[model samples]
Structures are given as C-alpha cells and as structure tokens.
Target: MNATGAWDRLEPKLAATNARVAALESDPSRRNSFVAYTMERDSAYCDLDGERLLMMSGYSYLGLAGDERVVAAAKAAVDVYGTGNHGVRALAGTIPLHEELEAEVARFAGRERALVFGSGYAANVGTVGALVGQGDTVLIDKYDHASIVDGCRLSGATVTRFRHNDVDHLERRLKAAAPTGVRLVIVDSVYSMDGDIAPLPELREVCDRYDALLMVDEAHALGVIGKTGGGIEEHFDHKVRVDVKLGTLSKAIPSMGGWIAGSHDLIGHLRYAARPFLFSAALGPAQTGAALESLRILRREPERVTHTQTQAQRLRTRLNDAGISTMDSTTAVLPVIAGSDDAAYDYATACRKAGVIGLPVVTPAVPNDLARLRIAVTARHTAADIDFAAEAFLTAAAQTGLI
Candidate 1:
C-alpha cells in the first residue's frame, strides 16, 4: 500500500501549471481568464487597478449586479439572519428564506417544487449523481458544463457523450446503448462558450422516442432569451417538455447558488438523496435574498432581455460585416473568433487598449483552433457602447489579422 512512487509523479503535473504561469507572467498583455475588475456605477465598464475598461466578459446578462434593490435585499437578510444559519439543510440550516426562495424559483421555472444548493456546481453534481447510478446510463452533450461532466463521472453510471447539439448523434448513442435502469439525457439549453441555443424541440422528440428523461441546464439561457426571459420552455413557447430544469443563481440572477425545479416527486427525492444539498450548509441568507429579488426584478422588467438581445445582434452584425466570425451565436453571449491562442490573446489586449474588455477564451473551454473572445452583453449597454465595442473589435481584429 506504499504511495511514495505515486506522490513523486504528482510534481510533474504541478510543474506543468507552473510553466504556464511563468509564460503568462512573462507577457503582461496576455490574459488567462482570471482578471479582476471592480464594477461600480456602470455595467458597461469596470475598473482594473484604476484603469477603466469597457466590460464584455461578464456574465451579468441582465445588468442587475449593482441594483440598489438587490443590494438592499441582501443587507436586510444579513440584519435578520445574522450572516448565516446554524447548520446544514437536513438540520437547523433550513431557514425560512431558503423555503421562500425555493418556492419563488419553482414558480418562476414553471415546476411544482424546487431545491437549492450552495452553488451551481453542487446542484448539478448532487442531482445527477443522486438520480442515476449503477445500471443507469447518462448521455450528455459533449460540450456540457464541467460540473455536469464531473457529475456523470461520479455517478457510477455508464456515461456516453454524443456530438455537441447533434440530435441524430444522440439518438444513435441511445439506440446503441443497453436497455437499462435509467436513461438520462442532459444538455445545456444555451451553450456558454458557443453562445448558441440548443435544439430543445428536436432533443425532446428524440428523448421521447427512446423513452429517456431529458434534463436541460438553463445556466446561460435565462435572462438572455425568450419573450419574458422565462428560459428554454418559454423560448420554445412551452411546447417541449424538459423533465428536469436546473440553473445557476449566479449568472444573470446576480446571486450565488444553484437550483433544480421539477415535479414534487422529483424535488422530494433530491431533498433526501442529494448529498451536497443534505450535507452541505444551506445557501446563505444574503445570497437567497438577493437571488429572490433579482428574479422578481427580471420578471417585472422583460424589456431588459429585449434590449440585451438587440444590442448583441447589432454587435454581431457589425462583427460579421467586418469579416469577423461570431460563430452561430444568437444570444447575449457572443464569441468573437480569433484563429489561434496567441491571436486571441492579442485580440483581447488590443481590444482592452481600444477600451473594450472582451477577454480571450482559450483551449479546453473551446477548441484550440476556435479560441475566441467570450463577450457578454447586458441590458445596460447603450447604442453608443455597442458601436464603440464593435469598432474596437473590428479594429483589433484588423490590427492583429485575427480574422
């Protein structure tokens, strides 16, 4: 049982990361996805060590991060709850705020019940692992979130990944699999990096044909799509049936947590069986309160979603007209394609110098050849801001030959 040999080999893996860090530090202009910025008055710009840059890589799609109401709600929760609860949800940590937030999420998501976890990562991993195991099979999109991939790997279920958003390929994988205990098909309703909407109707039809349960992660869909920003179902006019609808409270909601909404039975099972939810401490009162208020504001103000989509499309058209590819993006998230990793870095640096902050997305998040700037738009963006960013992107791409 001696592990000295195995421990010795771990140094090489750590050394590789150190090498990458050294490479990045050698060039101050090269970004590595970990930039810090202070967002104050304007959602259109963020301050970096006193330097103001036009923001684009943020996930606050609804532009509610600095809302006075959301901040007041969090402060109120802190005053009442005294920061945190006593224990985990299975015990004393079950605060009234948790129940209220769950109810609001369930109602908003068009489900009968809901459960909250400390983070979106916990929700995905906990739910998927608890729902299927042993004899079950989980078929996921190749481009599903890392948390989903981790959940599948840890579920003790046979896992298979089909081509990304390829319904026919999913059908082929399902047909080729053994008839088993549970067949769960999971996909992101809107892809994070590609910024494209999943073919939900087609996926549902295929899952129905194969008698599989379909789970759609609406992480990037909510607050960015549909007439009312009600997510995938609303985007598709309530036509398709997704057995499980789960999403992060952190993204557009501007809070901190993850949730799944479904029938009462499904939620009930998760409450008792999901280890991360049962064992981990419940979501903090401030985050729960903030999330609740943000959801309410989004519900009341659907026009924000419209403005976000409009600005995104306007920018996309500009990029396209300038001979730059945005891939197939149709949402607030836009991927400005830069041919190589170095080119993406250059594009980001140039864009920043030009006053827009579209950070480069490198390998593993997207294919190496497809490295891009994962620009995100918010409702707060003005026509002038959009024009400025478009001009920056075009000029940067031209200067670097990134097109």
Candidate 2:
C-alpha cells in the first residue's frame, strides 16, 4: 500500500453514486428530460435546447424575479453606488441601502430591528453561533434546513433533534433536557424538502412554557404565507411570536441575502459579533437596491401572495389528481417521494422529459430513504402549464414505473 493507495478505498461509495449518475445519463428519455443549464427567457417560458420547458423549479415564489421595477432599481443602484459595498459591514460595507433594507425587513416581520447577512445560510449560522454557546441547549426539528442544523453544531451547543412537526416530542425534550442557561428552539416555518408547515402555534406554546427563545427560518414561508407575507407566524395568526425570524431575500424578495428580524438588542449584538456578518462582505448595491424594491412591491402588491398560494394549491391538486404522489405540502413546494434515490432522479428526469423542470433532493441533503423530486410552483405558472406538467408527470411516472 502506498500513500495514494488510500484513494482506492473510496471506490465502493464513488462507484455507487457514479452508477446512479450513469443510469440517469444512459436513458434517452431521461437524458433530455431535465437539463442543467441556463436559457433565454421569452415571455413566460424559456427556450431550452430549442424546446420551451415549463420551468417548475424556480424559487421565485412571488414571481418578482424579472420585474421591471426591480431590475431598474438594481441597475440604478449599480450606476449610483458603483457595484460592491467594498468591505465588510463592520468596516465600510454598511451603507444607506443596507440600513433601509434592514429597516424595511424588520418592519415587515413586525420586529423592532433587523440584521442583514450575505445569505440565508450565513444568517442561520451566524445568529445561532452568536446567540447560543457551549452550555446552551438547541432543540432543532429533524426536517429543518441544513443551515439551521449546521448553525446549531457550529454554536457548540448541545443539540437534540425532535421529530418533525411533533409538538409532543418537542415539549418532552424541553422538559427532560432543558438548558441550564439559555434554551434556543429552532424550526423552519415550512419544511423546505417536504413543503409541510411546522406546528407554529404548538411550538410557540411549548417554547413559552419552557422559557426558551424561539427562532424560525422562514425561507420557504416568507413569500408564500401570511396575509402580509410575514410567514408562519402570520399564517398561524400568532400574535407577538418568534423571538427571532430569519428570512431570505433571494426567494421572495427577488434579490440576494438573508436577514434576521428581532429586537434592537439582538440585531445590535449580531451586527457586532456574528462571524459571517462581521467577516463577510456585505451585499452589493444592486442586490440591496433590488431587494428594497421587491420588498416595496410585496407590501404594495399583496395580490402577489394570493396568486402564489392559489397557484401552488392548483398545481398540487392537479398533480395529485394525475395519480402522482405530492406530499402533504400546503406551500409553494411539492415533493414527490420516490422510495429511493434512483427513483427520485428518475422522477426528476421524467418531469424534464415532459417539459417540466424540477430538482431532485437526495442524500445527505435529505435522508437517503426520503429522496424526493422537488417541485416549486411559481405565481407565473399558468393553468395550461400546470396541466401540461401534470400530464407529463403522469406519463413519465407510468413509463418509468414510478407510480
């Protein structure tokens, strides 16, 4: 055995994954099904390899990604602010646009203040690591996004996982292993992979009883929930809830970055101590400007939210009626559980062949046993598009023996 001989040991695992990829690439029907590349947008759909594929994998829940107003705002900011923020926020990155965006987000979420980060992953890891420490107990949902889980681990907190959306399990854990100092209970407003909503009301009640601070990552719920699109707290009509609310500007706001909406003190603390925010360069002028415009649009055009939910429900209904399994998703995301990883990839390929573009969620992003074909419904998708995708999925699933 030589120094490079160790590489031979990885052959088995690599071979397995390579075999899966090979199978996906081998099938002609699946080969042209889903393409991984960019396309030129013309009207509602895009031109992909000369075929107009109905894009169903976009996360622009409010369909503001290509809004003229947003584009103009971003461009104008680029011309005026001249691109980058130029430094870390603590140094020279903080600008008027960042301040304004933070203020707008905090107001939208009904919080006293907000702190902005380069991305949602940054916000979670930074806030979690900053707030909770070695002695604290962080209770996380099993199905929470990877960022939340990573944040807990990075915080050096004693992390305990609870069953997804199981309030009883949460309460039991809280009672049995309550933190001697600070207890941070974290969950996603909507489970990103499954599209199922967390039991916010129950969770909030439990947190109150345990005297724990509640944190919610509303990445999927932001643009798709609440009367004002404030996310799960608003969707469940929880008054004065969520000690910390995390939102992503990229999804609903049609720009980039993440924000934490909370008390003035919390925001102030993270501004000074959060590792990512302190060390990372702040969002550039264009993103900040576009996000501000998107936020304004969301506030003014509340109909976007209504349209998104209606569209999601319609698509979910159509998919279910087509004999395809759509998990218990109440939001814009719909996942087709494919018993195994290969099956999930096959389903994704089928959707692509049918002119529907979706993503495959497989291990370790999702549990190996819970691999799924993830579909995101946008407000821009029409009844015709939904019908086409539903029919295509039906045909592909039947052909692939997925159903």
* Cα TM-score per model: 0.97, 0.92
- The residue-by-residue lDDT of candidate 1 on 230-257, one tens digit each, is 8989999999879999989999999999
Count of backbone clashes for each model? 0, 2
Which residue pairs of candidate 2 clash?
A: 33-352, 33-353
Q: Which whole-number lDDT from 0 to 100 does residue 228 have in model 2?
A: 70
Pairs in steric clash, model 1: none
lDDT to native, each model: 0.89, 0.84
Error of 2 at 227 (Å): 2.1
Candidate 2 residue lDDT tens string, 1-403:
5666666888789999888677766765555334654533323466666777777777888888888899999999999899887799888878899999988998888889998899999999999999998889999999988888899889998999999899999999999884497998999998888899988878888999999999999999997888778799889876648888999998878888999998889998999889999999999999999999999999898888888788788878877877777878999899988878777778778777777777777778888788887888876777677778778777778987877
Best by TM-score, which number? 1
RMSD (Å) of each candidate, 1 decimal: 1.9, 2.7
Regions of candidate 1 where Cα sits further than 4 Å from its true position: 1-8
lDDT of 1 at 338: 80
